[model samples]
Target: MESPNNKRKRVKPILRCSTNEQSERSPDDQLAIIKAMADARDWEVLDPIRLEGRSGSLHATMDWAVEQVIAANRAGEDIDDAIVYDQSRMGRTGGFAFGTHKQQLAAAGIGFISVDCPIEGPHADFIQFANAEAARAQAISIAASSARSSQISLERGLRGHSTQAPYGLDRLYLNAQGEELFIIRKLADGTSLRLDPRTGAELERYPKGVRAYRKGGLETATLCIGSEEHRQVVIRIYRLRHEHGWRGVRIARELNDAGIPSPRGRHWTKDTVDGILMNEVYLGFAYARRYTDAIYFRHQDKAPERLEGPGGRKVRGYRPREDWFRVEYPKLTEYLPSKLRDAAARWQAAYWDRYEDGHVRSPERGQKRLHALSGILIEETTGQPMSATQSGTRANPKTYYLLPGSHQYSSQESFLRRRIPSAPLYRAIIDEIEMLVCDDDGLRDILRTEILKAEAERRAGDGEAESLRARYEKLGRKMESQIDLLGEDDDDVMRRKVEQTKAQRRAVMERLAEIDQGPRLTADQTDELVEQLIEALQSELAAFAAAGRPAFRKLTEMLIASAVADLRSGTVSIEFAVPASMIQHRFMGMDRPCEPKWRTHTHKWKSLPLAAITVELPERCDMDCWEPFEPKGCDDCRRQRRTA
Candidate 1:
């Protein structure tokens, strides 16, 4: 090897041409320019890389080249710098991505030679001015590119180009004189042409090819026509989903069972069926340019600086409806005689309803809780809800909510077994609720009083509300005036004033929203709802039973709060969500402390009834006049005799 100091520096050129302008300035032209630049310095140049518009921060194109530079420098080779045609082409994502790439290259001790941006570093602050111009140009170029793409797609759609016709329709490629053109799937000569994916028309080139297809004398390109078999299938699918009420999966299964091959020649799947259902083409609407490059790189967290995906390919993402070019083809009705549009709409509505409502997962047949008291039962020892466990086999099942002690360690001596059956537990709970509701001195009365008081407060509009509203409106106008007065003079002072006024306005609006509930509730409707709620609670057991598990859970949580069982003490403690007025009465005239610790502020929980734990007993087991007691013997001798 030559002496270490006598090595020639190796420089590699990075050449790129975006697909948008590939024809105007091909990669070959860019490579020639780079080669000329290297020739002037007599530096040994490596083969130039053609990125062809790969995505990332402007610096991303330099990444692979920099890696090579690092390796060459480390291996005692003399690679120190990478050459590029222009610096601004490195990125258009603005400072962040470009800055990151610069930092990375600096860490690798690699330098770059920009043909256009020759001046850089701390002494070259003026370079940023030139860069700003380039950035603006890039932005304009991006916008123009987007407009061109939209125009091209619009042209193709209306001209009857049959690249990829939507479902329920097929592309029939015809010349200008209505003579059909054949699609050659394979090439016969030393030429390049391929079928268009959307319209199925043979076109020249691979990817960026111009169509040699020409029409003469009153002939257009291709026309989409209804495919008889597919058209019938589409209509039937809509009917099955909407009219007959079927799930997407069910429809797909039926199609597969009928030996109907999908367009892709695969077994039908639910997503395939969903796509057909959602396609608007069957409804006579054709949408173009619904997907775009921005959408391809679009991610929820943040917009990417470069257009690329993790898989090194463009990712197709959803675009908004407004961006799509929509055209109507009313001729779709000819194939679908009975338009089941309403049915399709209903099907979509039903799907959303089920998705939002959520389905309950059914337990094993033996484990399913036929009685409502199954889930809420609490174990006092562990402070965890009791779980339903089956003791016997599937043939003969016995389900019980068992509390196996602290940590649920299944201690034989310490665990609590079921004291009551599931059915009886529900009966007892319902009876307690009924008593708490039907009695005049019960929770129902307290709730009713609170409701009436709230309504009365709402009806009597605040006397201070109108003044607050006026202040709010005035503050808003003052803020607007302050903003308008903002000038180069004393900007800080104006900003401070604006902020202070906004705070005041926000405070006013908050109080206003609190006072203004919009058109007060009708007295009759209020009374009716109050009555209905009370009636619902005292409703017959059948009515109570009619309540779904979810409704039951809500009501229980609203009123009962929580329930706990203590096996050792043989007692179950209950807490009520209902408030206790007896405690609140003590807090009157004591909103503030006379002397710090002496005054107490009441929290919502403290105002509620003190949590009570008592021995839980079946409602029917309460002393009947006919049953004899050990202490009192019997209420009457005849009653005792009847029991005996």
Candidate 2:
């Protein structure tokens, strides 16, 4: 047997842990592990080496630890292995120390052991691989839960776990005697609470009930923006959407480029920026959901496309806006009040109307199908542009006609010229165009100069490019500042900063290309542009034909024919299927059509009577077949009824 001293020198067995612990945690917890090692008289505890002279300096501690491990190897001690408390305290950085220092130590026959981990042995060459993986998983879990809880709390208007209070607010804390602290009346709406302003005490509790500013006081704070930190957030949100005129995507990109910290001090996303833009709380009100679970709630992800049923049709309903709870918090504008919002709302409303009007999502229900010429047709009476009206149907389908009341005899004249069958007239117009214009020279001219000019002007006036350029400049400055602050030795930091700057500059340059102040086209450019428009219309016709949707094809053909007819000549006229004046349920048992007695007829007594044709024009009559009809009476008679 060996002597007593030799027996005392024997190394204790390294602890092995199972995969599961308390509540899915491993059985070998941190405290349990430390006690077990102490009880077994382990060879060494291997406490993280602290720099002798320097404290709280990570670099110094790491250098000292590296030196200590190297020295122990040279000392000729029977150092079979080293043990550490856990992955985090073992090395300052994630895997740098373990993969570098630990690997070198193990090469000299020493092994590294983590008491609370199951990973071990010679095969575990990269001990950091295991430690880093565990650390990463822990971080992700913490982040996900924290994000979920924050979302729930915000939605419910509840106070979250935070340290600071807004400006004008004071946090009350316990005194040395553990008694309720004194109240400080600095609380402001829309502000976060931090340390007590008057007493300089740290806030360690929730329900630190806030107090409003004294009415009509000079120092009365408006917002709950407790600190300068939160004030910056409010300013940034306004700068992005209002000052810069940035859309949601641009706002996110700008924030990311500037390296501005989000509410949680992380990178910003489109959703985060959108949330800020939509949030009214910053406008001086706190509107949050009333109740929510205290824990994380994960909504199920939407199913993949292949797994969706029946083309993923959505149900429709009206959700009253008033029913949604809203509490005004301190804020600026409720939302960016601009033409962009109005335009977006109009588009959404129009889209919904198209779908709901005919109980189908098709061009037949869309205004673009029939009203492509809506803005061009002027009422002789009102001198205003005509507006299209949709008359829904069950037996025949949906029909579109111009609104009435602009011309004379609108209240009494039965203005039903054509209905869904008017599509045939549209088709006939296209056929006539094919016969008249051979090379599309005239059509191209109109498209290139006339219509495209208007569209280009509208696009140029839009502030999108200007906003992006401003955002790019802002981001560039921020990135340059960050780069300058980085140490010369930090190659990774410099490279990343340089790359980000290059990308942002490139985006800004692209936006500059779209900024056009000059005339969109020269006289020579009109023909080509008009030709392109015709070609696009032809493509639409082909698409409808291929899909076997006749109504859509007719609609496209009609719009092109009407536009061409209007521009080629000076006048544009459209005959509708059913006039608004004629819209009424039939009287019971009525047989013959009868004009109401109040309706009056007006016509010039031309010596020659107009000839009525025997063969009715194929609701698809070619444009060549119809001649321009001039009204000899009042201008009101010349204009088609608003209900025609």
Candidate 3:
């Protein structure tokens, strides 16, 4: 014990880890190991350091000690040596067990010693390697067990939560007051309440003694003049967009024009309108989870990055709506009327299905050429017309042709195939028209006849009837003005206006009839005759359907067929027709319809030789009953009959 020259050497601070072992050793094991330190005397004075472990178990103690040793080494400390009560105290096997303890000691420039093996260093190769392997295996086992526990919790809908709270809901936990802060509850007065720590308020209790207090809804409630009124407005908006065929932007504009106030009392923008339309709360249900959260790991920022979920790996980052939590928030949106709610639900479903199946297209991105051609095609057989399937609304695009399984055309594929290769038929019609119109004078005559017959009439002895004539003429002017306002080529609007004008004209004619005298050439009689003549002329002009005048049904059929064929083969052809007005304006050679004229001799007896007929009778055909093309059922057959 010694040479005076070996004067007391300075002792380094040391750290140690102790873990569970099969064998039980007491303080003697620790005390003996401590004695192996470089400055043995200092071991007597060094206080025992303890670290908190998982439990009060020995394994936990060792886990803590390992952490301490690793930390000390990182801080550049140089403890001379670490003492372990036994091999298992540090780890399981000799190699891995001692290997871990020795690695820690070596990292801190300290040597390791076991009480029973005083001559050995913790840094010895065998011990260091063994300890490392054992410690790694323990860590892996713990991880696997933790994962299994998490999986079980998920299956049970329990959560590890990691102290994380869902949005609009607080993480429930016992605080200093030992009270459940997030549990739903009914107070003594039977009011629902939730603990809001930020405001230091016990909000209205919920049924489950747990609830996430909603700030927006609460604020809306406070500001809402009447919840029913606000809910009615929301219902109206939803119905108009989802049920009534109004777009979100148009709905917003309509609401603003009607002086309706939005929930925020600001001008409604398209985005705001879209938000309202897309909101599920109005149906008395809504998923509290947001797409932003599902896609992005966090949602603190206004714009967050999209996160690809484990499930999203197969199909990009979209999560099915069914998978989202459908929380029933009883009050937030309960005010919506049942009928409106049902309608909105149906519309949303249809639109969602369309979106999912790639049936919807966007105009902003510019539609494909085929889509544009499809829009112009109308189905001749059915009254319905085709829309461009490739562009426009993302939810309900204008489709060129109806789907194959559609009730309107169950055999759509066959119908399209039969129609697509009708180029020869179309060419024949074109050839016939081209040859028929070869003589310009004959063509002009046809046009003149149609135009003149469409004009109104007048007769002699109608002098006293001028007042009624003027009234009729005034009505005609109004009708023309309305037609002009409606513009051209917009069938829906034009058809509506035409119906309205016809009703008004019918009333006028009825009034005229009531004032008419017997067929004695009286002033009233003459005016009545003139009006009847004009009406007859209109009927006759429509009946003399020329070969070049397009058959409305055939045109429609061709358009629909062309679109469907394009969809199958991915080929498209476009034809542009300049509007008559544009053509007239751009070129001065065309003749405009003459201003309405009122005359006696000029109107009644003048024949302008306006048309000529060179009928091509199909050889050996029965002129009395023969018809072209297969009957597309009754309505089309009736139209052909009337025109013939």
Per-structure clash totals for the candidates:
12, 52, 35
Residue 18 of model 1 has an lDDT of 50
Report how far residue 173 has shifted in candidate 2, in Å.
8.2
Q: Give the C-alpha lDDT of model 3.
A: 0.39
Q: On a 0 to 100 scale, what is the lDDT of residue 390 in model 3? A: 38
- In candidate 1 the C-alpha lDDT for residue 152 amounts to 51
* TM-score for all models, in order of appearance: 0.33, 0.22, 0.23
Return whichever of 1 and 2 wins on TM-score. Answer: 1
TM-score of 1: 0.33
Worst 10 residues of 2 by lDDT: 601-610
> What ranges in model 3 sit over 4 Å off?
1-300, 303-364, 368-382, 388-441, 456-644
What would the per-residue lDDT of candidate 3 be over residues 51-121, giving only the tens digit for each residue? 21122112334544665654343332323355554444454332533454556555434555555444444
Q: What is the C-alpha lDDT profile of model 1 across 39-80, one tens digit per residue?
A: 676456776656664543333344554545544443333344
Please name the candidate that would achieve the greatest TM-score relative to the true structure.
1
lDDT of each: 0.50, 0.39, 0.39
Per residue, candidate 2 scores C-alpha lDDT tens digits across 566-643 of 211223444321111111111111222343321111100111111111112333333443332221111132222321
Stretch of 10 with least lDDT, candidate 3: 216-225
TM-score-wise, the better of 2 and 3 is 3
